[model samples]
Target: MDPVRTGGLRVVRAAVVLCVRAAPGTVALSFVMMFVGGVTPVGLAWSTKLLLDGITAGDPAGRNAGVAGLVVLGVLTALLSHVRRYCDQELSRRVKVRTQIELFTAVSAYQGLAEIEDSAFHDRLRIARDASEFAPVQIMSSLLTLASSVITLAGFGYTLLRASPWLAGLVLLSALPTLRAQIRLARRHGEMIVRASPFWRRQAFYAALLLDPRAAKEIRLFGLAGNLRTRMAREIHAGQAEERAQDRETLRVDLGLAAMTSVLSGAALAYLAARIAAGHGTAGDLVVLIAALAATQTALTSAVLDVATTGELITTFGHYIDLTSRARPQPRPVAELAALTGEIAFHDVWFRYAPGQEWVLRGLDLVIPRGRSVALVGENGAGKSTIVKLLCGFYAPVRGRITWDGVDLADIEPLELRRRIRATFQDFMTYELSAADNIEVGDIGGGRGRADLAAAADWAGIGETLAGLPRGYDTLLSRTFSDSAGDGGHEPTPGVVLSGGQWQRLALARAVLRTSADLLILDEPSSGLDVRAEHEIHRRLSELRRGRTSLLISHRLNTVRDADTIVVLRDGVVAERGDHAALMAAGGVYAGLFRLQAAGFADETVPR
Candidate 1:
């Protein structure tokens, strides 16, 4: 009941199913090829003895017959080898394709994007990815070689036994040392792969930046190609040096073992020759015995190698299973989000990132009524964004009661909760998607049609920017984005690039499209925009603020001075609470920060 034994049986069963389904002829041909290939070496070894005996006895006809048989067997061996290799390659290619398709589906189904960010998981995933994508062909080739080698060695062993039991013993001993050393090295190399996969992934990324066409402009403009190349070269050299050092040690051990095996086999051959000279054995018998010994070594060494490769292949193949298990989709319950009410409340919340950390939100209590705009003005490090993320259901507070219309957030599915909220982050992703698609992505799977796209664009001041696109709303954003819009048979084009401000507006537009959402959040939406653009955005935001509950996180106090409430955050704790006038009179954390800002615009004499 070992798990590996159970899984291996399953894998083998699946492989057999595929093999039988693909080509029944090829499967049968494998056994035929193994048998035919095995007979050739045995035939040649036996014929050598006959040829030598006929020559020694001065029989020209018998010698010619033996020579003719050896020639025929050699031809047969070549043809069988070719047929076996051809069939194995074809079968493996098909299996590889099937494996890759399944891997894609399994990995794509993963909902936990956070797991993909972990180093250990990434390393394991790379191994699975390679095995699913490329290992089928290798496993197939190894299996074929293993089959042919075993059959040939068994046939050769019989001939060796007929000549002398000592010859067969020598053949077995000769391959043991080589097989032991090679197998150890192969296993060690596999271990190295486990350790080196992550490093290699990083190196590959840097190398891609150096070589890829899309990265060429950035590389040249930033003068990063040489630096990246040097960094990657260092990693490659370090890995290669370690492997080479191991290889050198392995080589020394292997050579010493090989030398000892050769001496033992050579001594056995000398004994057989001496027997032939003493008339205990004929010259033909000695010749046949040596040939049989050589064939046995070839086949036995191959079999041992095949076994080692198969072990490594299976070990790596298990990674695919592990990755699949981790990525298994959870069957979450469906909840009604269509008839949502926008009441949100956070009560007595105490939060921390992990068990041992200090609490970020201690006894936090807040509420945003069915439809209203609230502002959280905080100094850096005040847990303002954490509050926004909590509302958006990206993360749950370690200890808190967040209610959606009197229903605790814990009772609702995370995805379903997110569907009722929309937000633009300070560090929002500038996806390499078309201008229109950028907005459409906010309500992804909703398929809200072209009118939704235009509405969102207008709300966020992106319509003016979209008008300047190369294809209006259909120019490819990223250089790597292929011109496949036409091939999709939808629009003439459906991609467009945008500037930084334009991208920010597009992100805003994306948030705007989630019109059905009860709650909306915007974190530092106008941070780096020009003065005119910032004011325009603030003006546009006023229209959006009506009749919808929102939480705005901003350092620009002027924009949120008109909020229903303004809570000051300093050092992850609330320091003050009041409107612009009330906070100015209180003269606490908010008062100091506001005075600092207002003084920047004061005249030199007037400030004092």
Candidate 2:
């Protein structure tokens, strides 16, 4: 078998299995309905022929029986049509729900950012999402249609063959070209969609920018609306151009095939008319011949369409299969991971985001012992964030290893390793949820009560602020849903949006909620605060980090002055490490940077 055909068969098998598992009862009933519906047209044609013959012979009983059969079959056909539609809709809904769950689970359950950040991966993901919505359902529908068409074609073919063997052979042979053309067109359309995905993705990005609240101010201030709109329009036109070209080709091919079928049908009708004129056939035979020819053509056309459509859908669905079948990071066999009680050591570790790229960490060696605070100060792109990512097991070292106590990080399961650590990045998220949910998401599924949330908020110095909101902790923490109403008798009330400092405090509270975490990582925790807020937040942080195993990253030298040890990084390596006072006394990179920052606040009028 050809590879493409084999792959399509695999897709069909998988889709059938998925549909059956989603709604087995509905699927079985739908197949039964389709089988009955397929033969109804043949029965109607035969009844009409019987009525015509009986009318010519003056047979009253035969005419009445034919009329009754026609009435019963017509009504059954109508009812079955509607019932089958209902079954198909229900089956589609169930499959959509199941496939969507599986799709996102495969995406979210991945342990690293490497694939998620790749552009090619995102294209596949977008295609997979589209497949998730309709691919499996469509495959099942096309299969059912094909099955139904086969029955219709067989019944009509036999009738036509009995009436005139030559006409039956000609009609069946004429359908071969139509099937080949449809499959060829389907392959072209599938390829076009794959090529157009990047354009569609780019268009989605620009469209999102137009609606994003964060970009609204800058867009207006810079007069960027027109430029962004033009870019979005360009991408849309690019994708549509390909579709229009495909449509033109399809129209041309279909028109040519329709003309050929018309000519063949006309010739077949002439032959039958000549035979009847020769006294070899009756008016009843003419009616049956005409009906059989049309019915056979319709059934063959439908079967061809079903096969072509299934082929196209399977191509799109291949992306979903690829993503879901990808090899995920296997979990280590450790039943339970031990708490990080001793120390974490990074030994001669080297890493880069990609091969052949500049190394972000070059043979870097560091350690953080238990019950002590370590502060890392570095310039931009000096690998401060990279270290945090490596520590969290988001990526692995290209050379060397990181160990928790005596065990290598590579040996520990990523999820289990991360469970022992809590981190607050400089670019933390401000989730649009209720105040309580915003904080509680830190230790998700921990079942912590409101008291615990409030306590964590107090530790981050945001307890009073959250409690003072319109509905206290229950109040929404976003202006986006200000117009949305609450449950019960509560009417719409404007929700509040936190200021930068307040949002930062809320984020800290979130990190604080994970109190059971063994190692704490805080990256620029007070970067968004004002002078007074920063001072107050650091005061709270001092109490929080005291005698705790914590690694802090900050640019403000004054804030890290009280840390147990300060490490200054330059050129992907630790340049200096000591107490703040000792580093200042040494007059190295840390001392120079601290003096430059402190110089801005010097009292020129009094002290100078």
Candidate 3:
């Protein structure tokens, strides 16, 4: 089989499965209704012919029965039409919900962060997610529509053949040109949509920026609103121009097909009228022939259109399959990791984000001993955060190994390894959730209790501030959502937004909630705090660090002065090692940086 055809079949099969699994009863009923509706037109046409013949024969009883049958078929078709519409809508809703859940689950299953960071992956993900929302429903609807059209076409074609085989054949052949045109148009439209996806994504990004409260200050201060809006409009116009070209071509083809169809139908009707005038066929025969010819044209047109639409839908659905089928990172060994009782050492590790990129960590060797505070100090781009990412198992070393108690980290599952450590990043997220939910996410399994949540908040020095809120622990930490106090009323309360310093404290509280984690890592934990607030938070952190293995990364020399060990990194290599006093005595890079910072606060006397 051709690869494209095989892939399309797979997508169709998957869509069928989704529909059946989502709502089997509704799907079954929809098919039955479609069949009834499809065969009803033939029955109505024959009944009308019988009624006309019976009236001409002067048989009053037979004419009344035919009239009653026509009325019943008309009512039945109307009822089936309404019922089928309802079933289609309900089935679409169910399938959309199920497919979206499955797509997101596949995305979250990826353990490596590299794929998520890639721009190409984001584009594919956008296509996959959008396809999942509508493709399944479209495929099923097209299939049902096709089935109905096929039944109607076969029934009408048989009736037309009984009248005149040559006329039936001509009508069928006339539909070919329209079908061909529609198929070509559909292919062109699908290609255009794929080519324009990136532009659409950029337009969405700029539109989001305009609505984001966080960007409002910078956008106004820098006068960037006009520039951003203009860029967004440019992308929209570019996409629209391509679409308009395709639409113009489609309109031209369709108009040509319509003219051909009209000429063929007019010629066929004239021939049938002459046959009736020659007295070879009755008036009843003329009525039946006209009805069958019109019905056949309508049914064949719909079937062809359904085929074209389904082809486009399947093409879009290919993205969903490609994203879900992407190879995941290599699996780690199933062996259990031992407790972190010994030192965690990186043995001559080398790593880079991509193959051609400059090395972020080159032949780096370091040891973080158990039950001791290790401070990593360096300027920007010193591989400080890279080390944290490796330790957390977000990436593996390209050369050498990182070991916990002589056991290589590669031997343990990333999910399992992360369970024993907790860390806060320099760019920690400010989740738009309730205050309690924010902290609970840090230690999801342990922090469900109110007391545990409060204790963690207190340790980060944000407990008092949280208690002062209207809803305390339940207060929403963002202005994005309406807060409902659940007072059994319809009104919603306004949510509270936190300051940068307070959000930093909440992030710290989240990490502190993980009391069971063997290793605690803090990166720039005090960067957002004022001098007095930083001092208080550090005091609490120092008390909590006793007998715990912790890694602290900060540029402030004073904060790491009390650490058990201080390591300075430079250009992807460790440049200095020892406590603050020892490094100061050696007058190395760390010493120079510390002196430069201390000079900022030194008293200077100017002689006039």
Candidate 4:
């Protein structure tokens, strides 16, 4: 067997196993019904022949018996069809749910961001998700249908062979070309879908942009709906072009196969007519020959179709198997992370986003001593975020190592290491949940009550605003959803959206809610606040930082002037490290940036 065919068989087997495990009773019942359904048509054909012969011979009892048998079989077949349909739908639903859950679970288990950040992986993921939705069930259904068709073909073939072996052989042989054509078409269809996925993804992106509330404001402001619509249409056209070409090829091949079968049927009919004209065949023989010839062709065609459809479905489902089967990197033998008693140190760390990319951090060495606040100030693209990601263990160093106290970060369990750290990122999430729920999300497993949530909100300077909402802490914080569940039979109100600064404050409350965290990191924590609000929030943060190990990254020099140690990052290395006054005296990059920002605030012009 061909390697591709062998792989397809394996996928088919896996699909069978998955469906059986998902709903074994449904699978067994469906197959049993299919078998009965397959044999019913054969029974109907034989009964029609018996009825015709009984009428011709004036046998009234025989004709009546044939009529009764036909009626019973017809009703049974109809009932079986309905039951089979229900079973197929139930099996499909169960399998879809199982596959989707397993798919996402595997996705979430990925221990690194490298694969998640990959563009090609995104395409594969999208395809795999689509395959998960239907492929397994479709493959199983097709396989069962193929088996049913085979049973039908065997019965019809026996009838035809009894009438004339030559006719039966010719009818069976005609299906070979169709079977070959359908296999080719299936392969082409699978390839076309893979080729067109990128276009479909882009089309989906444009479609989503048109519907997104965030983009709606900018789109209307810039008058961009027409341009976006045009781009979306272009992607649709690109993808459809591939499909249309394949469809045309499929049509041509089908027409040729149809013509061949039609010619064979005509020849068989003429031969049967000559046998009857020569007085060598009875009226019943004529009826049986006509029915069996047509039935055999139909059964063979149906069988070929089921096989083709199964092949196509298996080809697509292979993507899901490939994605889920990929082995995750095993963790090295390491102990649980210990408390941060001494310092977090980066020793000669070097990193790049990918191979051949420009290095983001080059031979960088830094440290945050225990119970001391360290503020990292840098210009944009000075690797501030990269360092944060590295420290959070989202990525590892390309060459050097980071350590907790003296133990290498790579030697500590990732989950255990992260549980001791808390950070309010510059790009923190603003969840569309209740105000209290948003804060609670930060330390979900911490089991804190509403009072603890309120305290954290107060620490972030957002307690009063949240408390003033109509439903207090339970109020939904988004305009996207309405509070439709009424209280006391009264009409409910809609939720409200917060301002940027308010959302920022809420995110801060979320991070601060994790009071047990050992190392606190604040990245531009007051960037969205007004002047007075920023001043007030920074004062609270300064107090929060007192006698605690913290790392702060801020572009505002005034905010870090009172830190225990301020580190200036320039060219991916520490340019200066000391107290604010010491760095200002040194008058290096940090001093120049501070004076420049001060000039802007003092209403004095500064040369570029």
TM-score of every model versus the real structure: 0.79, 0.96, 0.94, 0.94
lDDT of 3 by residue, 1-608 (tens): 11134387887888788889999999899888778878888888878878898899887876887798799998998888788878878988898788788777778778778878987667667777788888887888788888888898888899788778998899998878788888888888877777777788889999999989889899999999999999999999988988899889988988888888888889998998998899967777788788888888888888888888888877777777766655443567744566789999999999999999999998999999999999999999999999999999888999989998888898888877888899888999988888999889998876269998999898888999999998898888878788876775636777899999999999999998877788999999999999999999888878877688999999998888888999999999899999989999999999999999989878676679
The sequence of per-residue lDDT tens digits that candidate 4 reaches over residues 566-607 is 998888888899999999999898899999998887895667
Most accurate candidate by TM-score: 2
Pairs that clash in candidate 4: none
Which runs of model 4 end up more than 4 angstroms from their true locations? 1-6, 327-332, 485-492, 604-608
* Candidate 1, residue 413: lDDT: 67
Which residue pairs of candidate 3 clash? none
**Quality of model 2 by C-alpha lDDT:** 0.88
lDDT measured at residue 374 in model 4 versus the true structure, 0 to 100: 96
lDDT of 1 by residue, 61-91 (tens): 8799889888888788777768877887777
lDDT-sorted candidate list, best first? 2, 4, 3, 1
Best by lDDT: 2
In candidate 3, how many Å is residue 380 off? 1.2
Q: Model 2 over residues 47-111: C-alpha lDDT tens digits? A: 88788888998988878878987999999998998998899899989999999888888997788
